[model samples]
Target: VEISQILLHQCQQEGDETADVGPGGDYRARNKLLEHLITGDETWLHLSTAETKPESVTWKRRSSPVTKKFKVQKSATK
Candidate 1:
């Protein structure tokens, strides 16, 4: 499934209380919850409790050239 779908599902599973942090609250809390979910940890996801508008959630996967080269070099070295 897509990351957004997984995230939204996770939020729903955790319940509305955790997903309903009002705007302007601590986004870092939400980010932390998302991080745990993405990283496959067992932490709870919490929504921000501020009065600001909710931020759009998005996800992207990035690969590192150094890691890619390292993998290739390790195979060559082997």
Candidate 2:
């Protein structure tokens, strides 16, 4: 629906009598203006992604058997 709308709009803007669905079986026109729009949109998307910071992960500590053994040995020596 969007592709058809775009094609129809562009065709109307260019004063065309009928709209063509482009060469590729899809409504994605090879029109320079539409191509610019697509690339510009992609550029904005990339910029937005690049400007954002990634989230940092939190770390947790786990209990270990080695620490328990060391504690037992230390208590015995004391």
Candidate 3:
């Protein structure tokens, strides 16, 4: 599928990058690349918790129904 092809392309690109700094290659470029490169593992985390339906209730007059605004909590990515 598309995912597999994308992963394959990434692997090939990684191989090419390594080859650039491998034996008989430009070691200086390797150092420069390493200095500027940033790497980290992909992680998903909940930065905030969303309120439940009951927790999202709003106080209003008996004869007047009021609208409740809900807060949306999104996940953090790296």
Candidate 4:
């Protein structure tokens, strides 16, 4: 399976910035985040580390991506 899509990387760099600048900087960031929240701003970007090829996500209910193979086996009595 292949997944090709641009994902919006929604993350606040506030924590890291705050760590470097201290509590005062964090308060401003907090305020900024709050303002965005109130105004519904889209502060998203694509991560440089984003993978173009996504790994297949198999569920716990069905461990493998080969679901049809298992389905046929389970319904073999038919």
Model 2 worst lDDT window (10 residues): 69-78
- Positional deviation of residue 65's Cα in model 4 after best superposition, in angstroms: 47
Off by over 4 Å in 1: 17-78
Residue-wise C-alpha lDDT for candidate 2, range 1-78, written one tens digit per residue: 998798778856865334457668666334545444643333222222122233433344666333221222222211
Summarize candidate 3's per-residue lDDT along 15-68 as a digit string, tens digits. 535424556775533333344547688877767776789997777898996676
For candidate 1, the C-alpha RMSD (Å) to the true structure equals 24.0
The lDDT per prediction is 0.48, 0.47, 0.62, 0.36
Model 3 RMSD in Å is 8.0
* TM-score for each candidate, following the candidate numbering: 0.23, 0.21, 0.35, 0.15
The lowest-lDDT stretch of 10 consecutive residues in candidate 4 is 1-10
Query: Candidate 4 clash total?
Result: 0
Residues 38-72 of candidate 1 have per-residue lDDT tens digits of: 34446554443333444432344566333221222
Give candidate 2's whole-model lDDT.
0.47
lDDT of model 4 at position 61:
52
Instruction: List clashing residue pairs in candidate 1.
Output: 23-50, 23-51, 23-52, 24-52, 25-50
Off by over 4 Å in 4: 1-11, 16-31, 39-78
Candidate 2 segments whose C-alpha is farther than 4 A from its true place: 17-78
Best prediction by TM-score: 3
